[model samples]
Target: MVRERSSHWNQKCRCLLLGLTVILILGAVVVFAAVILAGRRDPPAELPQWKGRGSTANLEEIILGRCFIYTRIVNPELRKDCLKIWETFKNAFVSKNPCNITEQDYQPLMELAAHPIQCNKTLLWSKTNELAHKYTKVQGNLLTLEDTLLGYMADGLTWCGSPSSSETNYQSCPHWRECANNPVSIYWKMASKTFAEAVCGVVHVMLNGSINHAFGNSSIFGSVEVHHLNPKKVHLMKIWVMHNIGEQPSDSCSGSSIKELKSIIEGKNITFSCEDDHRAVQLIQCVGQPEEPACRVCRTEF
Candidate 1:
């Protein structure tokens, strides 16, 4: 009897231990699941708030200020009726639907803002805004559209109109992609077209080589400017493909897109040539990144 009791006690103890082990495992699993759930519930990083309307604040003052500055300081010799220019620019879209604006609507403004571009001094760029502008400032011999009257006045400002009222829509403006012909987009297209048509002699095109499709067909330079270029006036088209100092180039002069550009220029009976990492531009790029190995090498070579 004693032996049987002892054996029964041992069996009970074993069963109890097994039950405790399962309970501990279940408790661990629950804890682990809670931690995972807490991590998932954490909030995400903040992003830029969407401005339902893309109009720049104080649009008139900004534009008028830029106009006066351009005329009085940038190009003192050229006299422009800043007030008349503003009126004509405002009339283009003040009472019309923002999406319905066309390049023709801006013709009067363009005519008023028109000025002569020096031959071989025009520098057009695609996907290289910052660097191109910097180059213009650094070199002092090249001029982009933004350096001119029309482009300077409206470089960073956004404006649109409401069809229901004869006033600028400060509350909301259509984005460039939201409509086929937003006012801002149409203005740039017309400006680019005009700028291209005025360019003569050796026209320089600066292109970014770090990104794919650096010479895309849809860009203003590719779509509007290239089409508007007057072969009769332009003597040679020089393409400079520039890349970031330390990064490998994603595209080059021999890239498919550039080849397409070359073919198009050839078809137009214009002289075309391309150079990779034009020394002047590369040196300018190196200015901001002197510590980079590639930039260091560039400094040594140049």
Candidate 2:
């Protein structure tokens, strides 16, 4: 009788062990499924369709702020009616077709914001926008279009309007290549022409020597500014061909493109001069590249 009871107890223990094992396995499977499901979350939501390639947000505030700041701090010697300037600027394209904008539309704004550019201080650039501006900032004697009131207010901003609406279109604007007469392109062309026309005495042009055809005919400097330059006012045109510290020189004073520029200027009866890797510009290029061999050599030579 004792043996039978003991066997019965052992059978019960075995059954209990089996039940626990099954329960444990089920729990593990449930946890694994939960972990997998949690890890497989849905992707992030997409942006709104209209939130792309549009006029800058708070465009008026930004432009007006720049205008006030420029008038108050940058060149206090000159006075500007910031409100009037803003109104004129808005009227140019606020109710017009973005693609139909022309240089003439911005004439009033340009004239209203126009300021005297010191003689021999104009700096024109092609394919060297950043470097040219940096050079101007560092040298302080040269001034690019962006340094003036008109260019300063609109630089690096996108703007457009619809013919049907009297408000700025913050949804989308035509790209420069999308249309021959996009609002932004026309404004820059007009600004460039005005700036170039005002240049007198010695004028400086900065070109990228690391790119082919640095002086591209389609560029603002080539097509608009160059055409507007007055031979009688501009006594000399100095070209600086700048190359990156480590880049192979792609174009220089003697390059075909430079030759073409020279021919054009000479034909126009303007004194033309070209220098390869001008020291002042090259020094500016070497600012953050002290380890470069070219920079080291340039440092020693200077």
Show where candidate 2 strays beyond 4 Å.
Answer: 1-52, 297-302
- Pick by lDDT: which candidate is best? 1
Q: Where is model 2 poorest over a 10-residue stretch in terms of lDDT?
A: 43-52
Model 1, C-alpha of 196: deviation from truth (Å):
0.4
Query: Roughly what TM-score does model 2 have, to 2 decimal places?
Result: 0.81
Q: What are the lDDT figures for the candidates, one per model?
A: 0.90, 0.89
Per-residue lDDT of candidate 2, residues 36-64 (tens digit): 99889876533222323889999999999
Model 1 TM-score (2 dp)? 0.80
Q: After superposition, how far is residue 132 of candidate 1 from its true place, in Å?
A: 0.3
RMSD of each: 21.0, 17.1
lDDT of 2: 0.89
Could you give candidate 1's per-residue lDDT for residues 1-302 as a string of tens digits?
99999999999999999999999999999999999999989584222222346578888899899999999999999999999999999999887878889878999999999999999899999999999999999899999999999899999888887776777777778776678688989999999999999999999999999998669999999999998999999979999999988898899999999999999998998999999999889888888898877666633544
